[model samples]
Target chain A: MILLDDGCPDFAGEMGEKTGIDFNRCLQCKTCANGCPFIDGMDQAPNRIIRMIQFGMAEEVLKTSTIWVCVGCNTCSSACPMAIDIPALMDGLRHAALDRGVEIPEPDILNFHQEVLNTVKKYGRTHKLEIMMRYKLKKMDLFSDMGVGLKMLKKRKLDLTPSRVKDMKAIEKIFQEP
Target chain B: MKRSSRNLDPGPSSGKLKFSFFPGCSLKASGHENTLSLLKFCQSMDIDLVELEDWNCCGSSSAHSIDKRSAKYLPMRNLSLAPRGVPLLIACPSCLLRLKSSFLSIKADPALRRDYEDFFEKPFDDELEIIHFFEIFNRVDLKDHMEILAGTLKGIRVAPYYGCMLFMPPDLRYEKSHTGIIEKSLKSLGADIVSYGYANRCCGTYLSVAKPDIARKVVNEIIFKAMEAGAECLVTACSMCHLNLEIRCTLDNPIPVLHFSELLSMALGAEDHKKWFPRHIVDPVPLLKKRGLLA
Candidate 1:
């Protein structure tokens, strides 16, 4: 299912245009994969994703868990000999994936991200407790990390109330954009 | 990110240095000990860090990962709020990346700067200085404040875990980096830094909650390596790393994770360990007491 399809030949070039990075410079030497701390969690080695992009396998690359699993720590980009902005490439791919409404390989991660944005939209800042609660509520799996949540609460790490900004109009102006 | 040529303007004892501090959500909400200790450290060094008033989140990982527009605007809003002619000091590495990259982007592109100005309804100040907490060290030597030149943390052994601080994105390669500042600073304070391979390893951030299994494995590995290398404790620069390392590590007899601010304040004889120590999940008091660093 993950094999290459030559239908989207413009994928790599378009990504280059979007991110201002040249994927052609990638040596495929796997410097990024080797340096990535999250490599174990990814389905594809970071290099393979680049190869997939170069081959115009847009759907496969978009659907892969590697893109979502990447936290954009820039470990790969910094270590890259070709100086390819691999994380930027990933961001381009992610935005493209969302635009196309493709099947997300990692929905929970996306859900978590959405929840964080939701908090920021409401308060003009991230409310960790609210984000965590809503994220767990959406998954209907709140019990899994209850111990860690309680520990954080006990430590006063998670605030009881959200830190709000007075300029709601300014926050609204930012979030109201398409 | 170029360091000012005048790194040594006035020593810590001579005058007060003022910086508009941007304590990201982590330090503001969850990392009480970190904030308390950090403020204490600044007060002792004659450095006055004024909080950025009504400052919002710097888009964080959420904005950039999914929403491009929000990412651009979130950090831009914070930039608009920056007071004229003063350095904006950010403590979180992730927050720094978001805000600094946004600043650099606007500075390089006149169109983006115009858009930012038009959006925020304020004129863009290109001369605004955005710096990190570590930048304070670059401006002064902590030894000036140390009454005993022989280092305050003489008996404590610390493992400085950077966790995604040194390796920045390509766009920010030219920015001033904090390479070895942790080890160098702590060493100057008399703390022996343990050598470990996983000091630069990623702490698996949000994954600690979304995919705990994966985060668990990585956190355990990092802790195990530091402990294996004879580190009595681990010190981190980011509050998120401190949270993830403390929460996700399932290993037996885990070493305490101290914020860099805590160690710095302690070494400088702040005498407020009682307020900070109880907040830690893995208490450093027993270890510090055993080493005679804390009584």
Candidate 2:
């Protein structure tokens, strides 16, 4: 029940421009799908997303959980017979999805990424504790993972203080730049 | 497998191997023990690591996935921070990929190089060698210390969980690789390598934070597989993978996951388990003690 936008017919070409990967070269051999460890969590296999881009199904492809669920592990791209950078493709799609203001199938993942960048923007490095607390605050369901959080604290896996870059002006400039 | 491994480059000039080290966010903030043991191992091997001054994030998976510009700038800034001539050694696998791929891109394009130089207010050194910690193995021969280090790791069974480090984008496919470097280096150190199916399985990184269920599933599978393969402990090459493996596994009595550097430090006769082992959720001390690796 999805219709291709005859307007942006070269969606694959557009993605290639964004990620520097030629999606048209994908053989659709399912090698990427077979090797992807997070395939079960992905609503669609990676190659299907590539095919969607090829067919100009931008809305469908951008809205899929596959892009957001991908941790950029590079399992598929490494095994890709066509040698396509599948993870790079996912990154491109996720950016595109965010840019275009489409519905994100995995809002939690998006929230996590935002929390991570938020800390980096502030401290010039990631603070696991802050990222977690901020994410839980935003999600407003922190108690669910309290056990794991407590465990990490007990093991000192999550640090109370962020190891920051000495020159805040430098990182401030990078984050502020257009 | 179509993934090709490359021959390693020559070791550094005889005595002291000094280089700039970027410990990325994972090690810098959370994995202090990984940093400590890594420094210990490097010192024992006479590898002097000068930490990169004011190095920022490497555009971790989160950066590239959300904002393209932040991703480019993060790694670009780290590149600008690298000292000239001496290679910049990144400790995290993901950071290595992010920085290395960006370096290759800047190297491949002239205009982008100028833009990067202009933005960062630093010259892009074409000769600046960006390397991973594994690359140091090519320069240091563990066998040379066998007289003192022998029998230190003899009875320990380790599963080397590379966890997606080897399976990077094809753009970097032809670059120098560290495939089987862990197994090769550890075997020479006398630890038994236990082969497992899930050694290369992705540890479901940020998912452990966002989608714990999926991360939990994959983590348990990896740990269970390693245990099934008779591994007494796991040696992970990545800090995030080490964290995820320890935290996400829901199995009862999971094996201790040690950083590759920690194991190397132990085998090199660096007796500092007290500093490193307590940080681990699953303490490797009991296993190391049982194997006579500790007094």
Candidate 3:
């Protein structure tokens, strides 16, 4: 059996303060877990996460791969009986993890996040080929996917050339703005 | 096919169907053709649109991920500006959802709503409707009329991509019915709809900029899925999705990407194929010519 308190804050109290998650009204109906598509795969289901977070397990809460696996589909939040913003809460945890500089559970997850920002930072807008090439190089097994790329090329679905917008500065500004 | 016995055209009504048009930033820049075609289609069908006076980006997948308030505020400002009676008509589903979710969050908590409303000059009442462009096309009997236009779409297998928004959270649909609105809408225009699962898959959109490796993986999955589904070309409703899928082919062949309206305008015998043809990374002219639709 799981410890009820475990040196964490009340489930309902911390949720309202930190993540804007409304756990006080949770009916414990498990509707969210049932509707959550990712629940089966999750070690701690959405409801449990809310419960754990409510108990103030901030460190342990932010250190799991569960946050990354969330597709952010909002199905759980949509189905929550208490209308708990579970998806937003998950995002909150992700941000908290980043702020604390905690080691992410998966290496690929952080790389994916960094790659996205890099592309946006570089071109103001992402160039598909550049993003793909960078990703392949970083992953260190670029040629493993080369066959698929060649096939797509043969079918004329993947274009080698990329064209940038004339007002690239405007795009840059959007990203650069504080 | 449900054939319409009477004139399906919704005759002039007493009250105009008013909605704030949020043509997300990409449409203003690279998606001009798409915006134009959508405008033309709306006009051709006698639909009224009230575009927001000075709209900006919805802060897309990146801004929100980076900072929540900043991302939510951008869409919130637009939602606050939306006309009261009609639902806000958004061309981009991602923007629609973001705005809708923000609005939903506000309504669920009055204090937060008031707090944010104060952040804006004018106080918002949270009585706005955020709708996708697809919703307007499917409202009431729009699809029935669209079916009449379907006989024109005979050739060309179009891979209709839905990206990650249009049908997520499950409640945003206009008609509340089960139908492949995108594909069926195109089919009504006489295009062969390629059946595929990737139609609703994420284009690795947020990943496109934030996580290239994952973005590449996701995009490649979309491409392979579309090809395996037998699509001659891919048609999308999202510009971001278009960007990710279009520029990735770094070889001799590239799949041509076109907005749904670009294809429809071609089939409806409206747009100039030459001008639009050269602009696309993939050549849609041959396909159009093969169908004897292009001059």
lDDT of 1 by residue, B1-295 (tens): 1113146335446556878889888888878789889988887886767788788988888788899989899999999998887799999888888899899999999999999988988999899999989899999777787657356787588889988854576767898878789988888778898999988788998998778888999899999999999999999999999999999999999999999999998887888778888888998888988988877
Best candidate per DockQ, number? 2
Clashing pairs in 1: none
Residues B176-254, candidate 2, lDDT per residue (tens digit)? 8788988988887788999989888899999999999999999999999999999999999999999999888889999
Cα miss at B268, model 2 (Å)? 1.6
Q: Which of candidates 1 and 3 reaches a greater lDDT?
A: 1
Off by over 4 Å in 3: A1-86, A98-178, B1-18, B123-126, B140-148, B170-179, B249-254, B273-275
* Model 1: how far residue A87 lies from native, Å: 1.0
Error of 3 at B165 (Å): 1.6
TM-score (chain B) for model 2?
0.93
Candidate 2: Cα lDDT at A130: 94
CAPRI-wise, candidate 1 is medium
